[model samples]
Structures are given as structure tokens and as C-alpha cells.
Target chain A: MTFLRDTATIFSREFAPVWRDPLSLVFTMAQPLLFLYLFGPLLENGTDTPGPAWQWFVPGILIMMCLSGPLMAGYFLLLDLIGGSMERLLVTPVSRTALLVGRTLKEFVVLLAQAVLIIGLAVPLGLDPHVPGVLTGLTLLVVFGIGLGGLSFVLAIVSAPGGELFYGVTQVVMFPLLLLSGVLLPVENGPGWLQVAAAVNPVTYVVEAERALFAGRFLDAPVLWGAAAAVVTALLGLHLARRRMARGL
Target chain B: MIHARGLTKTYTLKKTSVDAVRGVDLDVEPGQLVAFLGPNGAGKSTCLRMLTGLLPPTSGTARVAGHDVTTEAAAVRARIGYIGQKGGAGEAFRIGDELVTQGRCYGMTRRAARSRAEELLTVVGLDGMFARKPSTLSGGQRRRLDIALGLMNRPPLLFLDEPSTGLDPASRADIWSHILRLRADHGTTLFLTTHYLEEADAMAERVVVIDQGRIIADGTARRLKADLAGDRLTVTLHDPADVPRAAEIAAGLPGAAGLASDGPRLTLRVAAADRALPEFVRALDAAGLKIDTAESSRPTLDDVFLALTGRTIQDEEA
Candidate 1:
């Protein structure tokens, strides 16, 4: 009960300010738009047939949106820690489990919101985001974002940088995940070793399964791997982040 | 309440191992406010961290509010409020919601958490800053808010680490006032560590002075000062050359720890001036060295600490 309470409190308190800041709000909306415009038609128009290309690009964009939400949340974790804010929080009756769960869930909630906004916008761009199926797929994406964000928080916590180095780490975590997710191009077309690398990339399943959902195409292979990826990543992030926070290092 | 026996911690840094808190034993009732005073690197912070269960001791056991901090840290945390040396609010959230989140984290319902936050903000003198962001607060204000957050659960014990480090004089007084009143209002035990000698002397009922990972002295400020050192006497002679004669004269007095020439003045440590001053002055007149002026004052905690440890409290930090 205390865990849920703490987590929810952290979620609401943390997400509220980001929601209010106009600049952050504009950037959040603009991020996916920039990605869609920059990566979308460039890859699609470059291809012989742009129709299927847009279809593929839509899922990729949505996953990227989901991925960015959690990755950015790590920045907050790092700020709290280095500023001595997180240390102050520990002085209270708050359980470390609650602190970890609350902070991680807050990031997940934002990523979920971003996923919804992007997935909703994807429909008119020559792509079919089957509402219910895409919602479920993005829900999985939100879960994935939570896990990734948790990992990000732990990284931010562990890195514990002072100033400009913080934003540097944020971009480092974010850009790599976006590139590796195979959001814009087919995984097989990349380098052979990169193809082998993509097999184990949970983010690969995220884009493929989400793209399949957005295109309204039911694949022969089930999306169990993507769902598992979402759960495993989220839990792993939660477990490790919780342990780290508890140690109060 | 807290009871600790043989509480010890050793931190092995990259190359060297530091025994932060070698061995300590202490007892506190449910509502006592005991101040721990030490200079920089004196291990006061390390001991508080271990006592609060933030850091595990390398050896020994501690019970906070009757719960073992090692085996039942969850319960120990649940029962105490901790305000660390650094204010720990992250960049996200309004001050109000941060307090609410803290309340909820300790098991308050949403409505209860909100109400409790409102009450605590007022108590901590942050009533008007509810909607304001934490990033907007000044250092002292942020610390007060941090205190409010620590009190969210109304824990039985509160561990405050350097609560007055960077505050202005007025702000420090304001905080000390609140700390003194907390026990009366909430019956909360406060274990505070501070580098300010005056803060510990003026506020705490009992003081513990630690130096280099060991307990150098522990007692009420009065006893520590009175038992360890005598009152200091500063005397000025009419002529500078008369200092040596005055020193030789004062040395014969009962309980007088020989006089020393301090620049143009002579100073001595006397166990009891009331009993020895007259005889010492008679001897001084016999030596034909006139005592121009003399003054005696009780020793302070700083003197006691310096006397016992062979070094002043702020000396290490400097």
C-alpha cells in the first residue's frame, strides 16, 4: 500500500511540472514531428514505393517517441541526485522501494502519454494505426519506456555528473536507442553484424510489432517477444534501480 | 528511542581505509534531542548515516526506536524522519506535490497526504510557497522545506545532519527554536550533528564530541567544560617587564597552572579564583609587580573540546 502510494505521489508530482512548462510541452510535441519529417519522407520518398514506407515509418516514429520519454526522465533522476535533493528524500520515512518505483512509474506515465499523442497523429499520414491494436502496442511501448527510463535513472544516478556532462549522458542514452530500434529501415538491410545485433535488441521487436500493429497487419509470428521485452526491461530496470537507490550511494 | 552498542564503520576508499566511526555506544529516550558536535572529517556525519540506516556499519548493532537498524531498516526508516546535510528535492514538481508524494510514500492516502502536506508546510514556515517550485527556494528555505518533507509521516525520531550549516544568523536561530520546540509539540527524538559549537552548546541538552572516529568527550555542555578545564584568567601588569615576575608570583597560588607571558599581558588557568586570587595578589605585591587589571571567565565548550582533544574543533577544517 505504501509502495503504491509513494509511486503514485512521485508520478503525479514529477509529471505535473513537465506538463506545465510551455517550452517542455512544445518540445515534447515537436520532437516526434521533427523525427517524422526528417526521417519519415527521407526514407520513404527515397524508396521506390512510398506507401509501404510511410506505413513502416509511422511505427518507427511512435516507438522513438515512447523511447525518448523515458530516456529524458533519467535527466530528472540525475538532477535530483547531484543536487542533494534525492539524498534529502531519503531522510524521510519514504522507503527506497517506493522512491524507485515512484520515480520510474512517473517516467513511464509520461512515455505512455507521448506514445498516445504520436500514435494518434500517425493515422492521417498515409498509415493505418488500427486504434485498439495500436493502443495495446503503444501500451507495451510505454511499458518499454518505463523500463528504459528506469535504466536511464539508474545510469543518471550512477554517473552522478555535475553540469554539462548530464545532458551529454542524456543524449548518449537516447540517440543510440533510436538508431538501434530499426524504426526507419528494415533491419536486414543494415550491416550483417548489425543484423545479428538487431536479433537480440528488444527495441527491434518494439518497432516491428508496433509497425505491424499500426499497419493493421497481423503477422504469422506472435508479438510475445515484444510484450516480454517490455515486461523484462521494465522489471529489470525497476529491480536494478530499486537496489541502487536502496544502497543510497 | 535508540540504543547502540559498539557501533562501528570502516569505509575502504580507493586506496586507504578510514575508520569513520570506530566504536560508539549511546542511548536516547523517545523524545530527547541529543546534539553530536565534531569538526570536519570527525565522523559525525558517518555515524548519523549509520544510525539512520543509510549506511551499514562495518560492525556493531544499533536499535532505533526499538527496531534494529540492520535487520529491520524498513521499520527503522518508517519510524524516523531524516533531514540530510544536503536538501534532496529533484528538479521535478511543485513544493506542494513533493510534500504530498512524501506523505504518500509513507502510507498516507491521497487526501490525507495533501492535508498533511498543507499542515506541515505551515509548520515549517512555507505556507505561501505551496504552489511555488522547489528550485525557486533559497538555501535556508529549501532546508526548511526538506524538514517539512521529513516530518510527513510524523515519525517518532528525526535525524538532522548539519541543520544549520549555511543558514544566516537569524535563520539559524529560527531553526534552533523549532528544533527545541519539536519535542514538546510532537514528542520526537532529534539526533542532530553540527559543526557549530554555539549551536550545540545553546540547544542540545547533552552534547557528544567526536574526533577522528572516537568519542573525545560526552556530557552536558556545562559539565564537559567545568570538569575538564578550569576558568581562564587574563591579567595585565603595569610594566611589560613585570610579566615574568607576575608569572612567578601566580605559580605559587593553589591550583594555578603557571602563568605565561602573552604579548604584553600575562594569562593563567586557575582551578578556583575565588579561593586563590587573594593569596596570589598578596604574593604579587611582595614581588613588587602591580596587577594593572585582571578578569576571569568560565570556560566554554570550545575550550573543553580543545582541552580534551588537544586541538580546537574548527582547526581540522581549517
Candidate 2:
């Protein structure tokens, strides 16, 4: 109970600043909207995957939004490290796991809002996402956001010179994961090696699940796999973040 | 409130190791204000970090406020307030909010934390500036906020790492006055690190001088000065011709050592300026040399440092 209270306090602490500066919120949402509006349309007529182009593209855009939100969490952690804010909190009696959990939950909340806005925008653009499936997909996206954000926090803590190392390494890692996951393109019709790689990518399962849910395929194998992938990613990410912080972060 | 034996910290770099603090033994009684004096890279900050449970020592052990720093770090942290070299308040929060939140971190209820924040703000003389952000506060004001944050829990012992390092003269004096008041009112034991020799000389009841990761001298400033660095008497002759003759007469007297003349003036290092000055004056008068003026000066902490280490803190800094 104390852990939850402390996490709430930290969450409020992190949220208040971003709330004060609405420009940060606008900027955070702008990039995903730009991708959805600009790059999203270019793929409209290209894919012949037996569905409306918007339905096929919306899942990728949703996952893209999820990835982008958590990817920036590393930068926030880096700022806290450089600014001595992390050290300030470390000296306090607040639970170490509470610190990371608080920030991860904040990112999760923001990512959920972004997911809602993306799906709402898609509905008007000829995308007919099933209500129950979209709800389930949004829940999975929240878990994925926490996991991804937790991983970012870990990267920030373990890496020396947290800023450049996190950015450089995450950029290298994120692009490969995104490409292999078929967020922007279908891997089914691609080369056999690409398909094999996509099969191994955890994000590929999430993207496939979202694509199935977007087409109103509820209670399917894709949903189970996507939810499972999100849960595993979340567990690993949270555990890594908490363990790193526990070891003198 | 602080007791440590052989507390050491060694940082292992890529292929080599640097011993930042080596086998330091320290003890401080309750309510005693100790000024930790050292040059840069003397491991003062590292020592403070170790004691406050902010950093673990590489070897040895310490107990701060009755909690072992290594095994009971959380207990130590709960009992002591550490104001780091850099102010601990974050950039985003207002002064009152920061203090309140810090109080909550120590398990205070929100109402209690709010009241404590108000009381501390008044204590630090920041009553009207509660709404101001930390970044908007002046350097001295920010330090006061840091102090307020540190005092949120009202710990019996407080550790301030260079509290007045970057402040102006008036601000430094202001900080010292508040520190003294904290000791008087709450009996908070203050163990502070500083670069200012005069601040330690004038303020601290006890001064611990560390050099090259070792405690070279530790005592009251007066005792350290009188024991390590004796008083001096500088006599100026009426004419440049009288300098060597005055020096010769002064050197013959007891405790008048390091006698040297520069131009029309001659200086002698002596044990006690009060006892040695009159005899030296009589000797100079007996030598038929007319004295222009004479003055005796007591040794400062710098002098003590120089005597102990063969290098002044300023020289070490350079």
C-alpha cells in the first residue's frame, strides 16, 4: 500500500511538469499524428492484403505510436540523471521500484491517450475497428508501453553518459525491431529470411495481433500471442528496471 | 552522531584504481558543529557521501546516527539529512511544493508536510517566496531551500556538502548564521565541508583538515594554529641599514626563529607574539637600532595547513 502511494506521488511529480507545459504534450502527440496523416496515406493503395488500406495500416500506426512514446522515456530518464533529480529521490525513503513504476505508469497513461486519439482519428478515415477488439488492443498497447518505457529507464540507468549512449543504441535497436515487426510493411509477401526474422521479433506478434483485432477478429490466436508478447515484455522490462535501480542507481 | 573507522573508497577505472579516501577514522559528538576542511580532490565529498549512505565505501565500516552505512543504509538515510554540493531541489517544483514532497518522502502525512514546509520556509527566511520555482531563486535562496528540504524530517544530524561555496560574502555569512541558529534551536549536529578557511576558523567549534585522502590535523582552530603554526612578530627598522642589525639581535632571543629582513623591515617567527615581542623590542633598543613600527599577528588556519602539509590550500588548488 505504501509502495502504491509512493508510486502515485512520483507519478504526480512527473506529470505536473508536463502538464504545466502543454507544448510538450502537443509535441509528443504531433509526431505520431504526422506519421498517421502523412506516411500512413502513402501505404493506402500499395498493400493488396485483402482488406481496406486504413484497417491494415492503423495497427502499424498504433504500434508505432506505442514505440515512439516509450522511446522518448529514455530521454526523460537521462534528463533526471543529469539534473540530479534521480539522486535527490534516491536519497529519500521512496521505494526504488516505485520510482521506475511511477514513471512507467505515467508513460503508459500518456501512450493510452495517444492510442485513443489515433484510433478516433482512424475511425473517421474509413477504418472500421471493432469496439471490443480495439479495447483489447488498447489494453495490450498500455502494457507494451510500460514494458518499453521500463526498458528505456533501464537503458538510461546502466549506460554511462546516459544521453548519447541511450539515444544511439536505442535508435539502432528500435529501427531493426520496427522493420522486422512489419509495422510499416507486411512481411508475409517479403523474402523468406525477412519472414523468419519477423517470426522471431516479439513486436511482430503484437503488430499481427493488432492487425487481426483491427479487422474485428476477436478471441483469436493473434490476440493471445500479442497479449502474451506484451505481458512478457512488460515483466522483463519492469524487472530489469527495478533490478538496475535496486543496485545503486 | 558520526563514527567511522578505516572508512575507505576506491574507484576502479578501466585498468587502474584511484583511492579517493583511504582508511579515514572520524568521530563527532552530538550537537557539535564540525567544519571539514580540504583542498579539491581531497576526498571530503566522498567521505560525506559514504557517511550519509549516498555511496558505499569500498572497504571498512561506518555507523551514522546508530545505523551501519552498508547494511542499514535505508535506516541511515531515514535519520540524516544530506544537502549535497549541488542543491537537491528539482527544477520544476515551487519551493513549498518541493519541501512538502520531500517531507512526504520521509513518511510525513500531506497535512503535516505542508505545515512543516511552512515552518521551515519561515526558519530559512523564505516565507514570501513559496510560490517561486527553484530555478528562479537566487543561489543563496536556492541553498536555503535545499536546507529547508534537508530539515524536512528534522534529523538530529545534518550533513551539508560545501553549503556556501558559490555564494557571495554576505550570503556566506547569512548561511553561517542560519547554521548556527539551527544548532542552537534544534541542536542539529552539523558536519559541513568547506573551502573557506576563515569560515571554518571563525565558525566551527572543531575543524578537521584532510589532505591527500588523510586526516592530517583535527582540533579546534585555535589549538591547531597555536600548536602547529606559532605567532609571528614583524618589525620595521627606521632605516634600511638597521635591518640586518635588528635581525641579528632578534635571532639571539629565545623562540624568535625564521628571522629574515626584507629591505627596511625584518620579520621573525616566534612561539608566542605576546611574550616574545617585548624582549625582542628591548634587544633591538639595546642594539642601538631605532624601530619605526612593530606588529604581531596570530596564525590562521592556512598557516596551520601549511605547517602540517608543507603546502597551503591555495597552493594545492593551483
Candidate 3:
């Protein structure tokens, strides 16, 4: 019970800045909105997929937001570590797991709100609604986000006091993960090696699951694979992040 | 309220290992304000971190506020407040919100934390500035906010690392007054590290000096100065030829050491320059060596540091 309370405290503190500056929250969603309107239409007639572009493209955009949003969450942790705010918190009796969990909770909340806005906007653009499926897809997205955010925090701790490593690693790894996951374009037409690489990429399974769930397919193999990937990522990320927090930054 | 034995910390970075703190033992009674004095990179912050349970010791043990720092870190944390060297408030968060959050971290409920935040804001002279971001505050105001955050838990022990390092003199004095007031009001034990020698000498009840990962001196400032760096008495001779004779006469004086001569001037260290000066003067007169002028000066903490390590704290700071 104390852990939950501490997690809530941390979550509220982490979310306070965004709450005060609503404009910054909008700015965070701007890139996804841009992809939804501009690059989204490019897939309308160009792709061989059997559904309206909105159905196929909206879930991919949500996954994209999930990837970018949580992958960059560590930057704030890096700032706290560099500035001494994190150290101050560490000295307090707040549960260490709460510290990581609270920040990831903030990420989950932010991703949820963004996913809602993106889905709502896509509804008027000929996208059919699958209420339960969309809800589950959002759940999967948040689960994956929690994991990614945890990894980002782990990176932040490792790169602390000087955050150059955080920036360098994130920049180098983000695009490959996004691209190989087939978030923007399908890897089906690519060579066998590329498909194999995408097959191994956990993000690819998540994207496939998002597409399947959004199309109202509940029992697809992709859903199981994506759910497994997200759960595993979340468990690994939380374990590593909590261990790092416990060990001290 | 704090006790440690053989507390040590070593950092193994890549191939080279650095012993940041080696075999530190310390004890602090409740309500004692101890100023930890050391140069930069002297392991002052490292030792503080270990004591606060922020960093685990590589070996040894510390019990702060009745809990072992290693195994019972949370209990220790709950009973103490630590103000780090940097601004503790996040730049983006409101000062009041940060303080309240600190209170909440210690398990204070929302209503209680809010009231405590209001009270501490007034204590730190930051009343009505709850909405102000830390980035907008002046250096001194930011420091006060840090203090308010540290006090939110109302812990019996508070550790401040360089609490006034970058503040102006006026601000530094302001900080000291606040610290002294807090101690008086709550009898909170304060263990703070500081780079300013005068602040430590003027404010702290006891002083602990560390150098190169080892504690070299520990005592009251007065005692350390008197024992390690005695007062200096200098005399100007009527003739340069009399200086060598004056030096010999000065060495003969009881409790005199570090006798030196330069041209017509002579100087020596004595436990009390006031008592030794007149005796040395009479001896020089008996030898028929006249003195032009005599003066005595009391030693500062710097002098004590110099006597212990042969390097002034100011020189190390530079």
C-alpha cells in the first residue's frame, strides 16, 4: 500500500510539469499527427494491404508514438540525475521500484491520451471502430511503453552526471528499431534476411498485433506474439530499472 | 545520532581503482553542528553519500539515525534529510510542489504535506512563491528552497553537502542564519560539508578535516588551531647582524618552534604569542640585541590545515 502511494506521488510529480504546460504535451503529439495526415495518405493507394489506409495506418502511428514517446523518456531522468533532483529523491525513503514505476506510469498515461486523440481523429477519415480491439491495442501499446520507458531509465542511470551516452545510444538505436519493426512500411517485399531480422525484432510482432487487433481479429497468432513480446519487454525493463535504482545511480 | 566505523568507498572505473574514502570512523551526538571541511575531490561528498545511504560503502558499516545504512537504508532515509551539493528541486517543477513531493516521499499524507510545505516555505523565507519554478529563482532563493525540501520530513538529522558553496557572502550569511535557527528551534543535528574555511570556523561547533581520502584532523576549530598551528610572533631587529642571534634566543623561549630569520626580521611559532613575545624580547635585550617592532597574530583554520598537510585549503581550492 505504501509502495502504491509512493508510486502515485512520483507519478503526480513527474506529470506536474506537463500538466502546467499543456502546450508541451501538444508538441509531443505533433510529430505523430504529422505522420497521420501526411505520410498516412501515402499508404492509402500505394500499399497492397486489403483495408482502408486509416485502419492499417492509425495503429502503426500509435505504435510509432509509443516507440518515440517512451524511448525518449530517459532524457528527463538524465536531466534529473545531472541536476541533483534524482539524488535528492534517492535519499528519501520512497520505494526505489516506485521511482521507476511512477515515471513509467506517467509515460503510460501520456501514451494513452495521445493514442485516444489519434484514434478519435482517424475515425472521421473512414476508419472503422473495434471498441474492444482498440482498447486492447492501447493496452498493448502501454505495456510496451512501460518496458521501453524502463529501459530508457536504465540507460539514463548508466549515462548519468554526463548524458552524452544517453543521447548517442538513443539516436543510434531508435531508427533501426522503428524501421525494422515495419512501423512505417511493410517488410514483406524485402529480402529473406530482412524478413528474418524483422521476425526477430520484438517490435515487429507488436506492430503486427496492433494491426490485427485494430482490424477486429482477437485470436490471431500475431496478437499472442505481440502480447508475449510486450510482457517480456516490460518485465525485463522493470527488473533492470529496479535493480539499477536499488543499486544506486 | 550518527555513527560509523571503518566506512570506506572505492570506485573501480575501467582499469584504475580510486579510493574515494578509506577507513572513516565518525560519531555525532544529537544537536551538534559539525562542519566537514575539505578541498574539492577530498572525498567529503563521498563520505556524506555513504552516511546518507545514497551510496553503499565498498566495505565497513554506518548507522545513521539508529538504522544500519546498508541493510536498513530505507529506515535510515526516513529518519534523516539530505541536501545535496546541487539544487535539489527539479527546474521544471514549482518550488512548493517539490517540497510537498519531498514530504510525500517520506509518507506524509497530501493534507499534511501541503501544510508542512506552507510552514517550511515561511521558515525558509519563500512564502507565497510556491508556484515559482526553480529556474526563475536567484541562487540564494534556490538554496533556501533546497533547505525547505530537506526539512519537509522533519528528520532529526540533516546532512547538507556544500549548502552555501556558490552563494554570495551576504547570501552565505543568510544561509548560515537559517541553519543556526533551524538547529536552535528543533535541535536537529547538522552534518554539512563546506569549502569555505571561515564559515566552518565561525559557525560550526566542531570541525572535521579530510584530505586525499583520509581524515587528517578532527576537533573544535579552536583546539585544532591551538594544537596544530600555534600563534605566530614576529620581531624586527635593529640590525641585520642581530637576526641570527635573535633566532637563537627565540628558540630558547619555552613552547617555541618553527623559528626563522630573514634579514633584520625574525619569527617563531608559540602556543600563545602574547605570553612568549615579552619573554623573547627580554632575552634579546639581555643579549644586548635591540628590537625595532614586535607583533603577534592568531592562527586561522587555514593555518591549522597548513600545519597538518603543508597546503592551505585556499591553495587546494585554486
For residues A1-249, could you state the per-residue lDDT of candidate 1 as single tens digits? 656666666667676776677356557668788877666766655654324777778777777777766666777777777776677666556657766666667666666666666656655665666777777776777778778877877787767856455577767756666677676677667798888777877888877777666656556253667777789998998888878876666
| Best candidate (score: lDDT) | 3
- Fnat of every candidate, listed in order: 0.75, 0.38, 0.95
DockQ of each: 0.59, 0.52, 0.89
Q: Which stretches of candidate 2 lie over 4 Å from their true place?
A: A18-24, A48-50, A158-162, A170-180, A187-201, A216-232, B236-265
Candidates ranked, most accurate by lDDT first: 3, 2, 1
Model 3's TM-score against the true structure: 0.97
Query: How would you order the candidates by TM-score, starting with the best?
Result: 3, 2, 1
On TM-score, the leading prediction is 3
Q: Give the per-residue Cα lDDT of candidate 1 at B86.
A: 75
Model 2 Cα lDDT, one tens digit per residue, A1-249: 889888887887777667777567667788668878998778777755547888888888889878888877777777767765677677777777787778877787777777887888988877888888888888888888888888888888767443778878888988889999988778887999999999999999999899888777977898899989999999999888877776675
What's model 2's lDDT at B187?
94
lDDT of 3 by residue, B222-270 (tens): 8998899999999999999888878888887778899888888888899
Per-residue lDDT for B176 in model 3? 92
Greater lDDT among 2 and 3 belongs to: 3
In model 1, pairs of residues that clash are: A7-A102, A84-B88, A85-B88, A85-B89, A91-B82
User: Residue B53 in candidate 3 has what lDDT?
Assistant: 87
- The digit string of per-residue lDDT tens for model 2 on B155-247 reads 999998999989998898898888999999999999999989999999999999998888999999988987888888998889898787787
